[model samples]
Target: MIPGRDFPGKTALVLLTSLAVVISPALAFAHTGESGLVLLLPTDYYLLGGTLAVLASFCLIFLWPAARLERLCAASLPIGSLRVPSQTAISAIACLFLTALILSGLFGSRDPRSNPLPVTIWSVWWGSFVFVQAACGDLWYYLNPSIAPSRLVRSLLRRPAALLRYPGWLGHWPAILSFGFFSWLELVDLAPDDPTRLARFVLLYLGVTIAGMVLFGEDIWLARGDPFSFFLRLLAHLSPIDPRPMPADPARRRLFLVLPGSRLFHLPALTLSGTLFVLMTLSSVSFDGLSRTFRWLSLAGINPLEFPGRSAVLAFNTTGLFGVWLVVAAAYLGVIALGQLINPTWRLVRAAGLLVISIVPIALAYHFAHYLTILLMELQYVVQIYGDPLDRGWNPLGLQPNFVTASFLNDYHAVSIIWNLQAGAVVLGHLVAVAVAHVLNARLGGTGWRAVVAQVPLAILMVLYTLFGLWLLAAPNIG
Candidate 1:
């Protein structure tokens, strides 16, 4: 672990710079008056900067290989290296928190005043985080906080005499159930409106997930019937570490030949999964934003609702966009599989981080650029409807879908324009990430200059996309 002090100053500097850019008069002009004041809270920039900083730290640790950081991380671990138990506890807490949040939303009147930050952030970023961590590095183990609590419960419930025969399965179910349940909520039951109903649905999902894990051993199927595991075992010949035995007992295992590159083989799945997750998220955001923009145009008399069947028409469009997203995800996975065949031992952590890092410049460029459009477009609406931009009216029941519509359209044209730009930037970001990984792999070096240059394509693309989005925003509103 490098000394904490080594990076704090740099992190602080970057954070301060980001805040200044986000808060500058150039950026805030569109959100003028009370609306601008309300949106200018430091929390928004802090969250954004914090996320970036975490990524930067990961890069530093991986590329530079800091002994101090390693020590710091090691010191944090307990004598037994309590990562598993800690993961279990955290997963459980997350599951419980999610369940409680959903239940509260359902039972109480849907309040429009509730923070939408979680929903938006998750849609854009957290989904990718979960998929990348889970699919790539066996990070699911680290995230299972519920396991700790479950273990505690078992300890309290078990009799001293039963300790000799304690089951190894005691704390596994909470992590399994929490993961499976959250998956169901995101992949199957996500709904746009009727927050209360969605909340109730999520609670039920948690119950089912927890129940399933409790009944089935988390690793039983993997140990018994998973063909993928067998394939991995077969391919372990290329890995530097012994694959047949746990790292603790590698010397005793001769059944499988583990070469130097085995660890790298597992990364493609993470790369593919992370890529797909990001694509889907960006696609969803695009569909939502475009749909809203069109609706506004229709209302303005630029287009007709055709037959007063606005809801049905909207649903059809949304579903079609979702179908497109599914196709993109499938294609991305297919390509990843092909890549795996060519190079099974590709270094994953570095590759994944590099890929994600490469996209940051593009993300930065387009997010700011498109936000400009939303701000410009919504300025008039903000004045007309909200009276003051910063005056937040409370609505406890999230029943009012129009609240979002009003906020996005009325007070934020610049944001809308930026949203469109972001759609293009997202696609470009992925491309840039992949290109950087390939180039860096060829070069076999980790210099800061190279890293910045690797991100240049994405930055350029974002600038172009921003210009296009601005043009669209400036076009006359036909509706």
Candidate 2:
């Protein structure tokens, strides 16, 4: 253990008690997934420090003047340039890859882990690639499968414009709905990881995206209608690598190493729909964590140990998914309203649009914390599949079925390391969120003290959320 300082007696005791209350039905945490070792831990002790760290970060921000912070965020070093290949070529390759995965799903092994499609979608795409996007910048721009097909059709017809103009009033509601349905497919659906079912769903998604692109322009549809591309674009804003098209050659982009989240400094207030989109992103991830908890299963009248499969609670979990999102949406809007009460000049909705970007780091943190174990376990299967593209058991790599090992998860010491790593990520993410929120408030133009005062409510909410995030880590999980 990396020992530092322990929380004082009463404070530590109280936090432990709070953790108990939040995670009732004790020992529920130790039987499932990679979190089994968490039951005997001093998890609440970790939570106390995480909560304090978030509060300290919030307080520390008041010391730095807005200009100094802006300068800090804007600091960067040039990293030369790279010329991108034609989008049509890049997208065609991506499209071919997608087609191969779909074929593999249709004809390969029935096992979800062995199947290339499910492993790639659940483990590779959502698990690892997302973090890559947050580290590097918008690489997905060159890899969208829908773009190549749409562009090829447009060129063949000798018309750059689409069949119809995208409506201005529509906003990002289409993207919001796309994401909402996808969350359901990922979380509540009984056989989301089933190869054949997932392949069909992907086909449906491709058809819709292509039709929308052909009718209403690739750029607009991708930016406003497709869920994966738009969400990745949002994540790209937090990357340190800043890529901008070269003035002399549009094909090449100049890259600079700026501070992470620095791009957010220049982003204008989002539309009302855009704000909801951000909120929904956070809410759906939260629900994903919540739905898997022992507490949630108990509430739905399912025994944690006996654990009826997903088929039994499909309807109940489906409603719970939407219920969690609606509750989060309501609470977020209300918090913004409370903040607006302190500063009457700003309208309720616009104020939310301005500050919502600050939540991006928190959302990304949740993504990492919630899915890290899955990535660790499933990535082994991915490497195995490299040798057996169709899972035909060719034995070229001489890999045994034991290649997908869960031994580390069963060991207490290894599990502790994993848990601590997850805790650290959750804490650091909140600290960055506090800083981002402070910088954004400073952009509103006020004296130092006034700027600090304006963000007090937000800071408090962040602290509470920090506690919640920690609790989610130590909470009893269902699977």
Candidate 3:
């Protein structure tokens, strides 16, 4: 096995022990769904217990010296590598298929289940494919439909020159806007599930991406202009595999079996815009969970039983989404400032950038927990639709059963299993965040009692967030 260093046994023991304590039977239970399978909702006891578990972990981990953290954090095993194919060919085919998907959205069946576009976009792409991309690496680089055609044309003409220079001042601001807009479309759009509307939205994005690529350059445009690519790239840092080419062989890439969130340790301090982008990422997903809850409806003075569609709460949600982001950003910045106050040696911008990476584990964990059931329930439609994409009763694959229902929640034993999976995902995510914070703190040269004191502000912040996340999951969707 390709190996650089061994992971510290004490660190592993501490983490595993923390995980075990948090995941104990007394603290675990809750998964609300329409399937009549929820055993219990997260009560005050669960929340308090989870908070204590996380806080305790922070204290225990803080005692470990920076030198050991450097070793514990450094362990990586060498995994086998697979050679990638040419980007141009892959991108071209992906573009063609994406175009067909848009056409299908516009002309196919009006029913969401029968139509390929909405299911493909919402369930298959957003729910399923995104998670795969996060774990597997930035496959989107090869499959970026917008970037492909531009490269193909450039290659065909044998002219690989960019017409204009990308301004360094732009600093991914465009991508931030695009990402926010995309989030708005997904969470706040009224007709997101409607096929024709979904198709139009896809088509509009396609045109915008193509126009930007043509005017700027494909590489530069995609890096700054494409929100989805930027999103994927950020999440791709969490994957076990590193997509960067080997230094010795520029054309060949090697896969490393590093711990998740390891790459973030290597990232330099983020620009102001990039830091905002990270905040937006966390807040958007958090709001998505919050907006569906009864508490949110009550706060908005709406009856959960008689809840209106997205149209009625359009302004409220739009405003609330931004407000949620602002609150998170303020809290993060404030906590980092407080931490720096405890230890004046760390630079503010550098501290902000490093500490922000701690949020990656929590954000990703929430995303997985929030969308796990949605993916499981909706992906069946994705599978069934392939047989008759146009809803014309043409089974090209001659599949046996026309449709399948998710029975995982229906069965009592299976419900327990799925609930445990969700709870475990969340608890483990928080624990990992705590561990990452310890490592990051060490990276900032924090050690001993001073280091422990320095971590208090952010550590408390993480606990509060943990409480918020658990509450969101357990909160009934009366709205």
Candidate 4:
């Protein structure tokens, strides 16, 4: 779709490089009866077929209706001033609650003989990677679970006045300070295994988040100008919808409210984000559940816990996590939707669509890079263990007994080959996305191709460094 770009050539090069690194090794090692890991599974074939079928059905059901709805909205809504509410207090409370829950889970003793110090701290440290983004994008405001209900209650209390009143300033520096402090703790590994240290860290984060929201004002921080806001603005370009212009007039605006729809279906941003949140939670739960199931299944005729009960509990917890993630995602969408409501003429749908599309490449690259790095780094350890034939001692760090039963050297080689292939795919995916973005920009009169070209090297280097850091973590080492 991008003009002047040779997709075939780029794709061919990717394939060739992948083969040289992944497939060639397999062929050479074939004589030794060793096979390299293959990324694609037979199950993938069935999954792909099912996906196509579902997509076709969806198109048949909704494509025309969705188009008509879009046209109607485009014609009806008028442009007007935008007014997004402040969410400082709500966001602060959310940060506190979430931090408390995670800390409790991490530090609280689960078994009588088990110590809660090091493991809990390590868990929190790992969690830091996932929660850091909240500090980056005024994400606390969006992720806070209390916001919606609080706003509704406030509205009920105030009646007419609530309609126009925006959330007041709580503070901003507190959040920044909190983020910096936590980042320091994680980076320095200060008191790395101490529960007290982790508790202190959590307290500091909560204190800062709360203090900042109280001092600076959430609405002002969320508006354009701040670095986080700026990045979000740039990311917004990927969205198919626009949130800048207000709707044309009151009558047109009323139509959106009058339309009868499922709550999930009505909120496009919420639906998209919520779906992803659910999928991630489900995948994690399913992976763990299936693993437990297999372990039990292997025991000859010994039925452990009821499989149905175990599955039900897993499902419940998975659903709960999904709900929590959905709440956070919905809060984010709510903020943007408010912006759209303020300016009705804004094409929110198209902007949302584009943003969703743009994120795909980045998400894929992140996942592939993470898993590949893990596989590669682990392979090195496996090789060391297997290459030493005289060593019969258990390798706690090696994957032989833990991952799969095979010659340590052969298993490591297979994993390494797969990792290399995945890494190549990750790199290729990102480069292609950048190029595609540039091409799309040109077509849309956005940034020039030269700008994208200038940044490619830097982007690649950054990706490499990130992957390397992750690889270091993936290797077996005591926290």
| Model 2 Cα lDDT, one tens digit per residue, 314-384 | 99888988887788677777877777666665466777777888888888877887787778777678888
> Candidate 4 lDDT (Cα, whole model)?
0.34
**So what's the TM-score on candidate 2?**
0.88
TM-scores, all models, native as reference: 0.40, 0.88, 0.90, 0.34
Candidate 2 at 383: error in angstroms? 1.6
- For 351-373, candidate 3 gives per-residue lDDT tens digits of 88777777776767667766776
lDDT of 1: 0.36
Q: Which of 1 and 3 is the better model by lDDT? A: 3
Cα deviation at 472, candidate 2, in Å, is: 2.1
Q: Give the Å error, residue 77, model 4.
A: 24
Candidate 2 local distance difference test against the native: 0.74
Model 4: how large is the Cα RMSD against the reference? 19.5
Superior candidate under TM-score, 2 versus 4 = 2
lDDT of 1 by residue, 1-479 (tens): 11112334454365345434433323212211112222333544533443343233234323422233222222111112111234565777765655555654655435422423224223322333332331233343445323344344445755312233324443223333333333333333334334576565545544443333333323432222222221223223222233133366533322322212223322332233334344443334333334334444464354543434344455455455566467645543443343333444434333443343333333333333334443344333333322321226533343344444456545566444544344333333333333334333432344444433443333333333333333333323222
Instruction: Indicate the worst ten consecutive residues by lDDT in candidate 2.
Output: 24-33
Query: Candidate 3, overall lDDT?
Result: 0.74
Q: All models: lDDT?
A: 0.36, 0.74, 0.74, 0.34
Q: Weakest 10 consecutive residues, lDDT, candidate 4?
A: 255-264
